[model samples]
Target chain A: MTLKVYADRMSQPSRAVIIFCKLNGIDFEEVRVDLSKRQHLTPEFREINPMKKLPAIVDGRFKLFESHAILIYLACVFPGVADHWYPADLFKRAKIHSVLDWHHSNLRRGAATYVFNSALAPALGMPLNPEVAAEGEKLLSASLAKIESVWLKGKGRFLLGSLQPSIADLSLVCEIMQLEVVDEKDRERILGPHQRVLKWIDDTKNATQPYFDEVHSILSKVKEKLKKLQAERGVSANESIGRTTLHSKM
Target chain B: MTLKVYADRMSQPSRAVIIFCKLNGIDFEEVRVDLSKRQHLTPEFREINPMKKLPAIVDGRFKLFESHAILIYLACVFPGVADHWYPADLFKRAKIHSVLDWHHSNLRRGAATYVFNSALAPALGMPLNPEVAAEGEKLLSASLAKIESVWLKGKGRFLLGSLQPSIADLSLVCEIMQLEVVDEKDRERILGPHQRVLKWIDDTKNATQPYFDEVHSILSKVKEKLKKLQAERGVSANESIGRTTLHSKM
Candidate 1:
């Protein structure tokens, strides 16, 4: 039986997993767990992952959740995967683990929170909380600055100066990709200063190619849906939420 | 040269790393990074770990941070360390990774947030935000319930049905142990419901022995300091901050 991956492309981690499998030419079943419809919360899905979160996998009798875990497992169990993705050397692998662990509370949190409040909230009919959005922007900038100075400091193109893109690069660049849904001005202001980060994103994209674009295409549709919603409402929802003031404060 | 661990026992991750090294008998130098005194934020420490978090390590020329990464590195690098702690088996190690990744946003977040708000806030002369504390409690309860029913479902004494405790077990159990500094009644109310969790905690302590007790002793000092502060202040700080009404609502 092929490895089974339960995911929705809308989630950053899910997209990373999907792109990873495709990039590595790994055969797997993609099981969609729609978050917007709350399909992941169903009883049947709960049996597969009691956490009831997306990006889970069932490999034979083994069950696993958490996207980073799934990525590491796939890389380890599948002999065909390149070593650079998750190096066999203990020291290099440890560095990747450090980056992934830090990503949880740092880059992932800041990027996800900012995008959710800035774009997805109104699309989901939830009011944007400007105070939280302001906080998110601050965190987002800090996270981006760290990436520019620290993670990309090495001579190579991706994180930790790797010749090939690692899971950390895939996960983080996917997070930064979410900014496409935000207002153009706000997104630029948040992401503009980090030249290295922008270049690294492009580098990661070129490395992953068709799979990267394929996994991320859902976000483009999301952007279009958000645009249509604003057009139909006869106003930019961001303006209605006083996003200018929020951006200024940030 | 011996491994050097820069840590402060007050931080949960620091304690986890300290206990891990001691439990496995890895020789190390303990370099204190006093977070309370803002030592981690200094220019010198920043050179070592730009993230400036507690529990960084210097192993020869290679420096790394993030306790989970440090734990995995130590297990992999040091010979004669038992396999059960970080199994070489691909499936079991993946499950352990799943638990550790899930831990950051769930068990660790819930436990750390609740303890900081309820106990550390007053210790640091910061007022308690009861609303946030209530939310923390809800998350804490949900996390504990998941640990009991899902992670500890197997007959083994530790997470993922392991006969021996893994780093995931150490990190999470240490997070829960922070509740000792909270109000006795509140701590019991939050932790008492999960019998398996309690048993697992005891099992982990037994497995790690004197090192677990030694590393955790700082929390006892912290409990005493809190007691002294409450007596000197002549009122419950929680009452001053309206924690009771918030608890009633919750």
Candidate 2:
């Protein structure tokens, strides 16, 4: 049986998983979960993931959530490609795992929150709180400082010294790419003052260019659909009048 | 060469590592990093782990941090004990890994912050902030809710359905047990209102009684020494003062 991936293109982790599948030449059916309508909370989706989170998978009898876990599972289950994505050397593998663990609590959460509060909120026509946005920016700065000092410092090409991309880069690139979806001012703040990070972002994009193209294509379709829906409701992209909200309570 | 574990007993993840070593009959020399004196921030410690976090290990020139990663490495390094703590079954192992990842982002972080803010600050003769304490409590509640609904919802005696304990149980027991060190009111808030969670905590403790006793005995000794030093400085246990300023910027 072919693998099946349930994802939303706009969600960072979901995009990472999609790109991983594309890069690894794995064939999987993509089931998009509409984040704006909170479809993930419905009973059908809840049956797949009790946590009601995105980036879940079902391969025959096996089911899993947590994007990193899913990525690791893919690497392990598809052993032929493991050398490229998850290296075999004990310390090298551990470093990748360590960086991935760090990313969850640090970069992924901080960047996603900043984008959500500053960009997605305004895009969805919700009121953006300046206080929360400011806090998000502060957190983004602190998170990026650690990423620069600890993970990316002295690493060549890809994270963990991989000549090609690893799951570490996939995990990070997805979240950082969401910066573009944030307000232009916040994007400038993240990409402008942080020269090292900007260079890293460009390098990441170049490294995963093929997977990036596939993801961008999917996202463009999503964008067009969302645009048509908004126009039908007489809402402009910049106007704060739509009912879509990015965050799910559960 | 014997394994060397750098840890402090007061920290939850550190205690978990200590208990795992004792239970597995693995001999390791313990090197305590004094969080009170900020020993983890020293250059010497930074060489071992740039993150400057506890629960790091050195096994024959192989250095590893992150408690879950260390546990996996120890299990892998010591072959006979793998099935007991880290299971071999694919889905079962994935479940354990899933919880470990979730713990880092959720319960572990919140509970550690609570212990530091509520117990450690005042014990060290520093003022405590009610607002920070309140925020910590809120985060702790959200963590507990996730644990109850997601991880422990339909499990057996232990987290992974073991008649004997697993490392999943070991990791979780240490985290939940930190509630003991929290202030009396906060303790009541965690235990009294959350009956199901309270029962899970009791079950985990009972299952890991011997391991828990061994680690807690050493931890109690450390707590006694800290209390004596506080008393010598004439700091009242009941004094509610202003928020204590951290010497280093986070």
Candidate 3:
């Protein structure tokens, strides 16, 4: 049986997993567990991951959840995958682990929370929270700075100076991709100061190619869809959310 | 030169790293960087860890941060350490990764945020935010439920059904240890429902004895100090916090 990747494109980690499978030509089925529809909360889905989160995988009888775990598992189990994605050297692998762990608490938190409050909440008809957005933006900038000054200055195009993109590069870049849902100006303002981060994203994109773009096309559509929705709903909904996404994006 | 560990025992991750080294009998120097005095923010500390976080390690020329990464690095590098801490097997290690990654965003976030907003804030002389604390409580409960229903249900004494404790065990158990700072009643109120989780913490503590209690002695003193401070400051100090940490803890 083919490896089963249960995901929804809307989730940042889910997209990362889907793109990774495609990039490596790993034989897998994309089983959509849509978060918006509450599909992941169902009992059927719970059997795969008791946590009830997306981006889970099942290889034969063995099952796994959490994107970083899934990614690492794939890297190790799949013989066809390149060594650079998750090297055999202990130190190199540990460094990647550091980046991934930090990304979870720092990058993912800041990017996702900020995007959800600033953009997606209103578009999805949920209450907008400027307070959370502000806090997330502060964290977001700090994480970007860390990426630029500390992680991405490596000799290689990837994080920790690796010549090839590791799972860390893929995980973090996908997190930044969530910013695409925000208006063009906010996206620029948030990511602008970190030139290294921007270039590294581009480099990672180039490295993975067609799959990266193909996987992220869903996000671009969601952005356009959200802007059109906010434009239709008009002022009242966007008022609670400062920096309304509609006028700026449209 | 001995491996140098820069840490403050008050920080959860820092204590985990310290305890792990002692438990394994790895030679190291404990270089304290106190968080309360903002010592971690100093330029000298930044040289050790660019993120300015606790529990960084400098092994001769190699400097590393993020406790999970440091744990993995240590397990792989140190020959004296046992295999179960971070086994050589690909599958066993990947499962451990899942727990550690989940612990970061879910367990660590909920535990630390709740402890800070609910109990630690007023004790340390910061303003209370009941709204954030309530949200943290909800996340904390959900995380504990996951721990009970999912991770700890394994056949063995540790998570993932491992007969021996892994780094995942150390990292998470240390995170749960932060709850000690909260008033005893609230700790029971929050952790009471999750029987398996409580037992697992005990099991993990047993797996890494002496060092666990030795490292946590600082937290015990802090708990006492906070109680005395709150009592001395009087009721008005605890008024804003709805739960009122004084009566139950004392």
Candidate 4:
């Protein structure tokens, strides 16, 4: 039986899972669970994942959730895929696992909250909570700094210096990519200091190819909409009024 | 060179790693970093883990942080260890991974935050924010409910129906063990509803043996102190005054 992946591309981890399946040419069915519409919270979806999370998978009688776990499972089950993605070497795999585990409270929290406050909240017609936005920005900056100084500090193009990208690379880079949907100035402010991290993001994008772009199309559209709103407002991208106008539009 | 694990008994994940090492009989050195004294923040220790989190390890030249990652690395590197702790079976391992990953945001968050606000913050002489404490209780209760209804609903003594406890069981059980440090009334309210979760905790403790008790000795002391305080106050264990008296002692 073919693997079934339940995902919503808007979520960073979901995108990572979808991109992984697509990149490896794994035979799978992509089932979209729309988060914006709150589809994941429904009883039916809850049955698949009682946690009611996305990026879950079902292969015959077996079912799994948590994107990193799903990725590891795929890596182990699909022998056709290269080992570099989730290396078999004990030390190397452990290092990758370290990055994956750390990503949750650090990068994922920072990036996710930042994008939600700076971009998503406003777009969804909710007033931005200044305290949350400020906190989010602080977290985002710290996460970016860590990525620059720590994870991406190594000589390799990817995290952990692997020639090929691992699941950690996909998971983290997708998280950072959400910054694109934020206002240009906010994005630059949060992501600007990390030159190496920026390079790593580009490298990951290039390596993942067309599927990367495909999975990220919604974010690109969001970015474009924000840009057009700014243009219509006749205000600079960094100006507070531009954001206000965008908020009004929503 | 022997593996060097930097940990603190007070921290849940640190206890998880220490217990895993002791339980598996891995020859390693335990380097305690006293978190209450802010020892982990020292520049020297930060060299070992730039993230500055406890439960880091230095295995010769390869350094790793994050307890779950360390456990996986240990399971893989130590060939003689029993496989059920981190099974080689594809589906079984993935389910374990699923539990490990789900733990951080759910069980770990709820239990850690609940203990921090209700017990640690006050013990550290910090004022308790009632709002945060209430929120923590809600989260803790919800997390426990999920554990009983979802993770522990299976027939086996451990998660995933394994006859033997996996690292997920240790990681989660250690997290829940934090509740013991909380006030008696609050602890019962939060933990009382979930019989299965309670059973699983006992099962996990029994399975791991002396190491589980050794790692959790500090918590035991805290619990004993609270019980004594309750007795001295001439208040029932469920009474609010008992906690206030305990707070004064701390």
Q: Which structure among the candidates has the greatest DockQ?
A: 1
Predicted candidate 2 versus true structure: per-residue lDDT over B1-250, tens digit per residue: 9999999887788999988887788999999998878899999999888888888998888888888778877776685675868777767777777778777766777776777676667665587566676677777788787777666655575664555567777887788777765545768877676666787777877766687877876556655665675575455433422223332333
Model 3 C-alpha lDDT per residue in residues A1-250, reported as the tens digit of each score: 9999999999989989999899898999999998878899999999998889989999998998889999999998987999999898987887888889889879899998899999898655697799999999999999999898998785778899888899999999999999999989999998888888999999999999899999899888899899787787776556745555656776
DockQ metric for all predictions: 0.82, 0.42, 0.76, 0.74
How well is each residue in B88-170 modelled by candidate 1, as lDDT tens digits?
99988998999999999888888878888877887877877778888888999999999999989878999978888898999
Task: Evaluate all candidate structures by whole-model CA lDDT and list the values in order.
Answer: 0.89, 0.75, 0.89, 0.85
Q: Is the docking of candidate 3 incorrect, acceptable, medium or high quality?
A: medium
Task: Rate residue B125 of model 1 by lDDT.
Answer: 79
lDDT of 4 by residue, B122-200 (tens): 4455755667777777877887888778877667999877789999999999988888787778778877888888899
Model 2 bad stretches (over 4 Å): A123-126, A153-155, A193-196, A217-250, B124-127, B153-155, B193-196, B206-209, B218-250
TM-score of each: 0.93, 0.83, 0.92, 0.89
lDDT of 3 by residue, B112-145 (tens): 8898987788655697677888888998889989
Ranking by TM-score: 1, 3, 4, 2
Judge candidate 4 at residue A108 and give its lDDT.
Answer: 84
Q: Residue A144: error of model 2 in Å?
A: 2.6
Question: Per-residue lDDT of A90-122 in model 1, one digit per residue for the tens?
Answer: 998999999999999888888878888777886
lDDT, candidate 4, residue A205?
99
